[model samples]
Target: MPAAFPSSDPAIPTAPLTAEMRDALRAIVGEKGLIEDEHGKRPFVTDWRGLLVGGAGAVVRPGSTEEVAKVVRLCHQHGIAIVPQGGNTGLMGGATPWPAHTGIVLSLGRMNRVLDVDPVGYTMTVEAGCVLQTLQETASRHDRFLPLSLGAQGSCMIGGNLSTNAGGVQVLRYGNARNLVLGLEVVLPSGEVWDGLRALKKDNTGYDLKHLFMGAEGTLGIITKAVLKLWPAPKDVCTAWLAIRDPRAALEILSEAHSASEDNVGSCELMSRAAVDMVLRHIPGTQDPLKADTPWYLLLEWSSARARQDGAEGMSEKMEQFLADQLEAGRVLDAVIAQTGNQSRNMWRIRESVAEASRAEGPGMSFDISVAISSIPEFIARGLEAALDILPTIRPYPLGHIGDGNLHFSFMGPSGMDQQTLAQYKGAITRAVNDLVTSLGGSISAEHGIGIDKLDELSHYRSKTELDIMRTIKRALDPQNIMNPGKVLRL
Candidate 1:
């Protein structure tokens, strides 16, 4: 069920929108672009995670970058807030409309397009609405690779990825969306377009403004399009699922595998036995990666260019041999190395289905956090201890892109624990976990971002000086606080 909001809230703008305002907005975008029906805006009104359900004055599906710019310009002119959205696959509730409904949702889903693909330059210029998988396929057509592979790649937009600076499985090697982006085309709060779409390797001309909006969560401006950097397609690929005793052993095994395969290690994800069990139990056709139920598992990948591979020099054999050594050394419990592409994909299916499988369990509080690679084990130990102490019956589902020191810490409720009760204790639990994370020199938010869901927590974790500067920038760019207002930072 969708979460409910308080009827009497200060943030919600209760003042009605005048007929003159609607006419002015409709004139900027076409009549067809304007969506007035409450039912018509229902789908776009709520967030993907179902954490935040809101109402908007109207939904405007912009067809082009210019149309988006015009809509933003009009919102700015009237001091109305604007929430730019893409596929709405965000977990942070960043794209959800405000209850104030004082704003309009700028949906760029209609602007989906691959404007240009330069195989020679190893870059692609795409609209914000282009699906991640589409971008990957388009890159593959030219014998290149767009390595930002997230679970939501099938439905999420490149715009949302860029906005979140998304880090997926490949972050262990390819880095996040911020690294993949070479240039960006954004629409400022003032309704002006800043086209910094130069796909250059090194251009230190002035301030690198792109980085500011990359993870700003749309608080500053709206990202309309972007030029993403790609890489040469890897020829030889290897995937393996190894059973480790714990996160410490998983990290140790990852270290050994990297030594044997060099930096060819593309992805090294850590998964708990419980996490894998959830997938096998809930996800259809999903089976255990290994025969025995170990305490933890590691999904390892090694990719190399075609020219780099030689006969009898496959990395899988080396990876398997290393795992064998670790098993003998008591570092690992058991392991299964994929012999074919299909088998490798099957193993990945277990890792990727974690989120969905978790949902089948029950309503819970989810956390995306990160710490130094070496500090992860301690963080987990302390975090789990803290969480269990607070919610004894809470099932701890700890998993994530461990290679990046990030973990998706979730607490599954036992039978009969209503979501409302869980939600009521959410702040206390998050504070407990975040306090531990902060003490370990870690971040409260790893990859998900500080959308509306964690805005208060962000303010809690961030220093006053840092938040002051962020507010200064938001006010400087969006004086009226109309562009994605009440999101990342609120004045």
Candidate 2:
């Protein structure tokens, strides 16, 4: 983690939005698409947590790719910076403009539309602003599935999801957001549209250009539309809550689950008892599935496209048998398979609500990092030792998408300590934890992209060659450095 930026302006394109330029923007998009009022532009400039307040002269919502290109073209001509935003639900300040930004916030909200759905091809073409949950439901309506899910699915847009290359619980099965996309239509910094919206699965024509923009945080270009991959809908699914012996047991159980469930392990999430309790305490309508005398728990789900018929041994039966075997092996101390839809929903609700619960609990630090699957238990052990040594009273609630080796390493500040006080120790605590991660060949910022939060950390952790290549790409694609200036890379 890195310290927050100072109030003073850093080097960004300060070209003020002139009256003529505003008129040009208004002409490109209708009045409803343009938000020049301070109150109207507030949400676009502010980060999701409301902790980072940025400044923007206006917020421009384009209804079409054409409109988006026109707005970018106008900005490019005048040397004005543009921060491309989608859903504005990003944890990183990638979509939020800098406090000194005197240009526009290009919002994709008005452009949301599902353009096409090819059931035969198993693909869907959609505008960038379409909400993730909306796309999931759309896929369901077509009897297909979109597996890129997240806690913020209801509000996070697909463009933002791709921009951050987001990873959620299902990444183990469906891969990250980038993996779910077939192609993209991006508006480059020079106002040129890159129409790479092919629905083909195998296009090795040249450099994988779509990938560059997918995780670039809109620093390289503005993603306006995309062609997304779809999978067959899961008809037989089983959800379970298990109290495991320890972190190491989690790995073993998951390792065996693939064959036991016939290779349909959709998700394997590790939850600390503290994390579960925190969720149960804050989130209403969520209940504990089981209470066992163990500090570690696992939320395992197995799903398959094959529907279960009468007299068939469904997912639950398979899972029940698997749990029995694990319990006999001394791996799972206790476990319960979800018997009803409501029961399954409750189990998932607890896992998804951890972020909300943490916010309600107050001042806390969370690091989203990933390591080799086998290295997870060791990383957890050494990482906790290092963090606790720096701040002994720090409350630990270590949890994650354990199957994918990504941990939401989190902690509550010591009792009675305010956020300001906790900030003083953040540097040391961050270093110890990240050092352990780096030593194990793990990522410091997993799932979450390097926005303002980890801008300096990326610079510090990445090799000079890696950073140099990134800076070179950023410069070549956006020479003016006006595309989301002062984000990701410091150049």
Candidate 3:
């Protein structure tokens, strides 16, 4: 194991599962619901990155909220730890257990069920384990739209999305996962269900407890169900790929885009030529939408609910005029509007495939950081300079949701450099990048929560008063520290 990941924490219970405990777990979840063999438990303990592999006593799949409560109660009674999982698709090691864990991996996969869809109210109540793509499709069938979307949506569950407070491309318009949720039902550390699953637009109840579990990353409680807010389905839409002059030009174009697009901008993604090429190299059948000499590129999208008429001007016409003006003004070097659905899909495929391509290419590090929208260009420029100053050979492949100011600052290892060699420079590079971010008043973590990967980073950057409040809440809810111990906080 890496030195950063320790097998045990003093506050967390590490009692091994004995025969009686195993029997009790099996009895609660039944034989079909339990996986005791190593082969069966491997995937649950392994993180999405395939690094940070941990250990679990057994894997438990509960079919309903009641069953989940019982399993949690049983574990609580025995003073055993519990790691709640939705899809096991998290980039951070939030769902993975510790190597010394004697706890059960409680997966909510079988509890996936769309409880209700209220089109009139623009709300959908669903079990947490429902796949994000499935929920999108369900909402689409009702002529409503679920705005939460990402590269992992095909496999990632809604519960994990909410737990991480995921930010996707649509966040430029609709906002993050937490913004889309109206209420949530969570199972506390004590196995008590806190039912806040109401479809109300206005609820000023005490504390607004649902917000606590949404971004807690399973450290406070397990999100079992949620009432999701929806939007009207988009009709006329336009997607254009532009090779911009630079990051500053990209921001200027985006600033003018809102008024040009009539405030219908859906997404504005900033991509470097290196990141685009990396995606095309690894993701099969993905074709480059446009090729230009500029290093910076922008994928701009606009959508409106009103359908295009026979001859009336629509999103495409407006976007075409905007691009022409930008090109004349020197902000855009070259551009191409996706003329077909396949072309538009190709553009999205390149953007979304960046993550999968990075994984396949091997031995790389990425930081999901954010700053003020205006500070993004300056941050990126200085951020890259600081990193290259440390190691010039470190290949930079930066990309981002420029409209929202979240950048996935990433880099692959220098050619021919092995994992061990790259690991040596990680500490220095991470410190440099994070230090720059802190100095600029930017966040170290943007959409991804402070899971195992950023536990220490959070402590280092956050004020003592903030951390003390968080620790107090964690201890109050889980005095035993049995809820995902040794993952988020040192305690």
What are the lDDT figures for the candidates, one per model?
Answer: 0.83, 0.91, 0.90
Report clashes for each candidate as comma-separated counts: 1, 0, 0
Model 3 Cα RMSD, 1 decimal: 1.4
> What is the Cα-based TM-score of model 1?
0.96
lDDT of 3: 0.90
- For residues 1-491, write the lDDT of model 1, one tens digit per residue: 76654323325223445688788778877898889998888888788766678878888888888888887887777777788888898888788876766668888888898999999999999999999999999999999999999888888999988888899999988888899998999999999999998899899989999999999888788888899998999877888888778888878877777778867889988887778887888989877768775677788888887554456667766676777799898987877788877788889888888777777877887899999888889988988988888888888878888888989987677678888888777767888999998998899888889877777888888999999999898879988777776777657
Candidate closer to the true structure by TM-score (higher is better), 1 or 2: 2
User: Candidate 1: where is the Cα deviation over 4 Å?
Assistant: 4-16, 307-310
Model 3 misplaced stretches (Cα beyond 4 Å): 1-11
Which pairs in model 1 have colliding backbones?
Answer: 13-100
lDDT of 2 by residue, 458-490 (tens): 888999999999999999999999999988888
Give TM-scores for every candidate, taking all chains together and pairing residue i with residue i.
0.96, 0.98, 0.98
> Which residue pairs collide in model 2, if any?
none
Per-residue lDDT of 1-491 in model 3, one digit per residue for the tens? 23245333435688778899888878888999999999999999998877778889999898888888888888888788999898888877888887788888899999899999999999999998999999999999999999998999999999999999999999999999999999899999999999999998898867988889988999899899999999999999999999999999999999999999999999999999999999999999999888787799999999998889999999999999999999999999999999999999999999998989988887888999999889888888898998898889999999999999999999998988777688888888999999989988899999988778888888889999999999999999999888888767877
lDDT assessment of candidate 2: 0.91
The predictions' CA RMSDs to the true structure, in order, are 1.9, 1.7, 1.4
Best lDDT among the predictions, by candidate number: 2
